[model samples]
Target chain A: MAVTLSQDGRFHRQLIFINGLLPMVLMGFDAWRGKLGVNPAEFVTRATGVMTLVFLVLTLLVTPLRKLLGWNWLLKQRRLLGLFAFFYCCGHLLTYLAFDRDWQLGTVFEDVVKRRFIAVGMFSFALMVPLAVTSTNAMIKKLGGARWAQLHRLTYYITIGGVLHYYMIVKSDATYPLWFAAVVVVLLGYRVVVSLRKARERVAVGVER
Target chain B: MNPISKIPSSEITPEETFLNRRFFMKTAIWAGSAVATGGMYRAFSPRSDVKSTGSEIATVVDSTFQSSLGADEKVNSFGEIAGYNNYYEFSTDKSAVAAKAKDFVTDPWSVEVGGLVGKPRVFGLEDLLKMESEERVYRFRCVEGWSMVIPWVGFPLAKLLSLVEPRSEATHVAFETYYDLKQMPDAGSAGIDLPYVEGLRMDEAMHPLTLLATGLYGKTLPNQNGAPIRLVVPWKYGFKSIKSVVKITLTNREPPTTWSLANPGEYGFYSNVNPKVDHPRWSQAKERRIGEAGSRETLMFNGYEAQVAHLYAGMNFEEDF
Candidate 1:
């Protein structure tokens, strides 16, 4: 698939569309079939959260995959993937507001203040708004590459907020959040290690000079 | 991969076709004979297994007595009552009591009555049930946090304690539940103190709001529900109504309770379902109407404030809370 997708925009688009929407469709079908037993509101909330994390990870992988494997096509799909992450994050917030809070804005505000989980989730959602807004090619050009990259760095903080939100809201099981945290750690760990190595190389070069 | 005709004669066998035909005939005959025999049995035999009454199999036996509730009663029936639970030891989950409490053994359940009473005696559940009049009706409110109107049928707690004839040393009455961790499984596992003990002032115990319940919705109490007997304090949070009760100690001084001891700032022995007194963690002003049976506003003192509020009129709820 990677060999064929080297020059193929259509193939990458197909991959993005299927990866972004298939899980949602399957979950929706299961819900409509009454297989989820209870209200399925929590299920939707959980699924959206997980997919948000998944797309965030995929978006982060773009730079590394391009650098290592010389697949520039991965860079073209980053914006789409990041937008999809925000889309699911919006769905996550919507499910909580609609089913959990009944869309009572007053109560939603109360929850944002009163519950720590809501605060964390709202923060993650807030971070996504800017990322989604700047995802367009025109905005990217307007912001310029350096400033845009700096702004998008907020996604790391968004990932942390998302994980904490999930962890705090879960009353019993920590396994899912624990797994997500571990994955986030590994991904973020890669970036930190690369940065540190680059810093050491720059220092060593300076000393040699 | 080759066609079947390419096989050797030795491997095929001359009698193979004949044996196969015979086997098919035998299978057909046996199946036909079995069906014919089953039909004959159905035709001649009495329909003992058939539910001609058009009722479901009773997983629980029906109670001989009715709730015979007071004038202000609001609920009835086993289906409605049994679904509602107030077991806090198993966590706040509504199904927790029913699911986790099966591990509790109420077989040799007995209550020790002492202190300030003229007749201090230990009474088994069987003996206690014999003394009380049985009636089933909805009683609601729990501390693990939920509300349900249940069809409960047992004599008033006041009526039974009167048999003991207090000598008036009982300024405060304390109730103790079975404390055996071996028998009551969730006692230590819940991360909350187990064998929960709750107390009421002597007047509160003798009040009409207190009940020593044995059965509900016209049947023996299910094993998960303290089985043989439990207390029902309709005005208090469900935790105040101790389950699998085995002892009653009337004291000259106020007795310590599980929640008060566990979190002094939160739960008090006088843990009445008052809308005004909010729990430290959440509001007691409102409660989710479980089973979605009726979305009625949760009442003050679970709507029994008129009957129970006066007991704590001079006292501070926030202090003890």
Candidate 2:
């Protein structure tokens, strides 16, 4: 039974890996075929940003899913979801720097400050970097428990910045931003409720003692 | 794959995504969705893609005819006239005016100069241009955030207003853009205030800073850039520089501008690019020199304070602005 369960887990892992590579493959194929048009960088960068938001929301859903569905095992996949979110975020940032501005530092800096959309995007990128760096067990251990958790709390800011960036960049139509904002509200609400419950239990225990 | 298993797997599992599932199925579901969505967007959208269909694009008569201007008057690069736009009714996209504005009917364009004018006359584009000398290069500033210097070819608004012969009661001059909600798709959108109009105080209207542009880059103004005629107030935010103007009404009372009414805090009557007055969303400390990659420090009144600042005079800019 243990071996079979391990095999299933491995299969899921492989599935996740395949899923991650698929988008990149499709992007490459589109570029090669000249179907994606000349601005492949814009496409790739925008896709990565949207995917990052999607995965970040998914990562935040682990705790809620565990409570709602009695699926405690969902917690085990949280880090994987978070790391995938970070990966896409890195890709998004790289594409902007490499293709959008042709790796011009001055132009990139100006865009980050001068353009409202770029500024929000850069803020989101800034937040994601810290979360990505501390994702590893060694770094998490070095930062200690409370500090590590506090550092990861920057995800809330990141999600806000990402949504704002998406909103500002688009010339018109805000349905995507509205959807992401809704998901983020739910995710953050769940965290707040869970934290309140934990705090209440701690206070109750102390009073009883 | 088995749905019957009740026991939760103890081992830490990696995550999976929709794309991964699609890959396993050997189908690009995401790409398919994107293409379908794009198609739906195009089909449902009222505005036609001007670039797609070879609609009546205005002939760029003179390819190398950058307007003649003094060295001090010229910016390093006149922003891409193709992109720097004022297509208020259709859309706000910089490229939208150039791309989708050809469909706009400009041949029969006329201006109704009424209100405090002694002779309120509706003059056609041909008649109007014939009345005034060609054009002048002016810097274009947008309210949404961006600035551009364009080699605009048009005579001063003061020049035309002087010809009209205004009454003493004309304290404010209001200009209205030709607004057809059906034709200009963006007019119907909740985000924008329809029938886009802007006003200038009597002094500003009479000032040399004000222009009524008929041509740009020594060519007839592109339909997207308000081909027939448009107001160009160099010192104020771009929205104040109204476009595709069909009417100019000089009234005794100050007219409420479309932008100031839409967003009171961000856009004011005197939306001078003052570094001191930051926009609600972002700072106006630096502006990308239109057509150039690098940005320069944004000056007070977009570097036109010396000439136009006196018009504000004793009025507190912070209060009225």
Q: In terms of docking quality, how is candidate 2 classified?
A: incorrect
Task: Flag regions of model 1 displaced more than 4 Å.
Answer: A1-103, A110-121, A131-209, B1-93, B143-145, B165-167, B179-189, B293-295, B315-321
- Superposed on all Cα atoms, the candidates' RMSDs to the truth, in angstroms, are 13.0, 8.2
Tens-digit lDDT track of model 1 for A135-201:
8889989999999999999988998888888777553335568788898888788889999999999
lDDT tens digits by residue: candidate 1, B1-321: 769878987786556665676557656655665555445423322111111111221232344633333454445334334434545555333333455565566666778888889998888866776764555354577653456667665777887788788876678888777666565545555545666778888888888757787766556577556667788888788777777787888888888887787777677778877777766444566554444422334577787766778887787767755
The model with the greatest DockQ is: 2
User: Candidate 1 chain A: minimum summed lDDT over ten consecutive residues — where?
Assistant: A34-43
lDDT of 2 by residue, B1-321 (tens): 676465566543434544455355534544554455445433322232222222222422332323333364445232245544557566644445565566777778899999998988888877766754544556665554456667666666887788789999899999898988667766675366668778999899999767887776656666777776888887777768888899999999989888788778767877776767666555566554444444456667776777878877797767776
Two-chain DockQ for each candidate model? 0.04, 0.13
Weakest ten-residue segment in model 2 chain B by summed lDDT: B48-57
Q: Which ten residues in a row have the lowest lDDT in candidate 2 chain A?
A: A1-10
